[model samples]
Target: MSQQENPSSLRLQILTCHLAASSRNMASEKEAALAAVPSDSRTIFDKIINKEIPAKVVFEDDKVLALRDIAPQAPTHILLIPKVRDGLTGISKAEKKHCEILGRLLYTAKLVAKQEGLDDGFRLVINDGPNGCQSVYHLHIHLIGGRQMNWPPG
Candidate 1:
């Protein structure tokens, strides 16, 4: 015979699930208001990394991958990101252990810029949370070049 379920345990489970869902809803609303993606969810970058989406890959290694941005802000706009996230949703979530990969990403950006023939100069940008206008949840470096950039970026 099957044992009866405990009423107290059942109620606790229901309450826990409700609380978790409510928290997620609240976070989603906040992200939406700021025009940012949810941090805890898998973003479009995953597709790019998995080769499910087409991207002009400029560089790739075991640790990082660099690809041309679909919507290019400059003549040469490359995005560099870690192949494996390892819980690094954004730079804001970086821990001490992530330092090596973070440095590798920046160094990769410089290497790509040289390969792209940006002899004059190049710009590297990393948008953090919502205030920084980060629409994607994944952490990435934007290597932009091939034009004269204006100060006080628009």
Candidate 2:
């Protein structure tokens, strides 16, 4: 018998369709929430930089701040961010004027990694957008180390 002619099969198909639609709606809602705020608006990183929010700062210079990650993926996960965002919400938003600061962020990451005694090795990551799993809007670099790293990171 055709699936439509079988009540059980028809019910299963309907349920599957319902679940798919629900999943799509949930994804849409999540995307909407992520986009609710303007990209250039202040993010949690801004609060941390401003000292409005407390963070375990490991290193700080005139232009950059390196702090321990709240939810560390590795034993030595630190976030390096520029004090003045200057419209750099992500690396993709970088312009010519942002070059200096960008270089500074990377160099500071290196310094922090060395300070953390990741003498063996470390990884630097800059997640750009929603697909990159970037929860924060402000541009920053992640210095992860203290364990063996695997290839093809998600």
TM-score list, all predictions:
0.75, 0.76
Candidate 2, poorest ten consecutive residues by summed lDDT: 29-38
Candidate 1: tens digits of C-alpha lDDT, residues 1-154:
2221544443344344334433343444334324443456776778888999888899999999999987777899899999888888889999999999999998898899999999999999887654454567788999999999877553
Candidate 1 Cα lDDT to native: 0.76
lDDT of 2: 0.77
Give lDDT per model, in order: 0.76, 0.77
Error of 2 at 8 (Å): 32
> Top model by TM-score, which number?
2
Error of 1 at 10 (Å): 35
